[model samples]
Target: MTEKSMLVVSAHSADFVWRAGGAIALHKKNGYRVKVVCLSFGERGESAKLWRKGPDMTIEKVKAARREEALAAAENLGAECEFFDLGDYPLRVSDEALLRLVDVYRDVQPAFVLSHSQKDPYNFDHPLAMHVAQEARIIAQAEGHNPGQKIVGAPPVYAFEPHQTEQCEWIPNTFLDITEVWDVKRRAIECMAGQEHLWEYYTRVAQQRGVQAKRNIGITVKRDIQYAEGYMRLTPAVVGDLS
Candidate 1:
């Protein structure tokens, strides 16, 4: 049997750590090699904490700090991290960048993919990342898209929960009970020193999702879930048996 792999595409360096660290850690524990692609370092817009350190912070400085944080976070989750370094603030995904993502899709040949929500009013970059991820997935599956490169298999794509779920129109259709890996996720969350305010917020989100997961299906399984992550599957799942 072939080895299973998972891929996650994020708009910013810290986005994956905040949204999908639990899922990444859980899958890695289950013998899947996970890869993360960060479109940008979010240096300009998302580095408020670093920026507040007086006027000495340069773009390079911010990028370096965010990259370090992201690397630490990915390491905590047992995943490999790649950075595109595309500038943010008004995060734009160029055609070249999209092609790079296509290359990643072909290279990883991920069994499943995770990305941002399709719509996010608070951060347009989040939705843009989703668009690029979707397009890259489609292109990667087509043999003719790149003449010399081998096409990749179709993988189910799941969008992780956004910060403001209601505003983003993100509904959680899948809940992963990550109770056992919550500590790992917490450690990953702490790696983002530039975004200290979000640590507790995401932790609370996990707990709330865990409560919802418990009410929804935990009772049936007779399991107690203290932490969970929610996702919206964007692709059809094929299985030998529905159960």
Candidate 2:
């Protein structure tokens, strides 16, 4: 049988680490081949600390640092990562870039896809990333987009948690219990040195999500969930049974 795979489309280098790190680590532990596509290094907008490192900080330098951090995080989570090098702080995805993402969809043939929320008032780039991710999925399923290449199936799409769930209007319909891989996720989260301030915040988010996940699973399940990742599933779940 073919190995299962999952794809994560991130607007910035560290987005994947903060939002879906638990999912990445847990799914990898479950034998899924994980792939992360970072649309940009978030040099201008997200790298505030790197910029404060004196007057000699350049965009290239910041980007390099972000790249290293993202790579380390992906490595810790056992996932392969690809960088688009597209500048952030108003991420622009050209027709060429969109097609490139389509190619990734065909190549990975992901069992499911993860990306940002559809709406983020604080970060416009976040919504744009999700827009492109869904657009690419549609194009990848089109036989005429790249004739003769294998087309991808109808893989479910999920929007990972945003920083401000209420503001972004993102509600989690799916919760993944990531207690077993919480340590691995934390290790990956630590790799993001530039965003140290958010480390504890996301950790708390995981703990809160875990409580919600446990409540949803009921008290009779007898499973202890200490950490979890929330996702707003964008597509319908086609299941054989409703159990």
Q: Model 1 segments beyond 4 Å from truth?
A: 239-241
List TM-score per model, in order.
Answer: 0.96, 0.99
User: Model 2: per-residue lDDT, tens digit, 1-243?
Assistant: 899999999999999999999989988999999999999999999999999999999999999999999999999999999999889988999999999999999999999999999999999999999999999999999989869999999999999999999999999999999999999999999999999999999999999999999999999999999999999999998899999
lDDT tens digits, residues 44-104, model 1?
A: 9999999999888899999999999999999999999999998887899889999999999
The worst-scoring run of ten residues by lDDT in candidate 1 lies at 215-224
Best by lDDT: 2
The global Cα lDDT (0 to 1) of model 1 is 0.93
Separately for all candidates shown, the number of backbone clashes (residues 3 or more apart, or on different chains) is 0, 0
**Clash pairs for candidate 2:** none
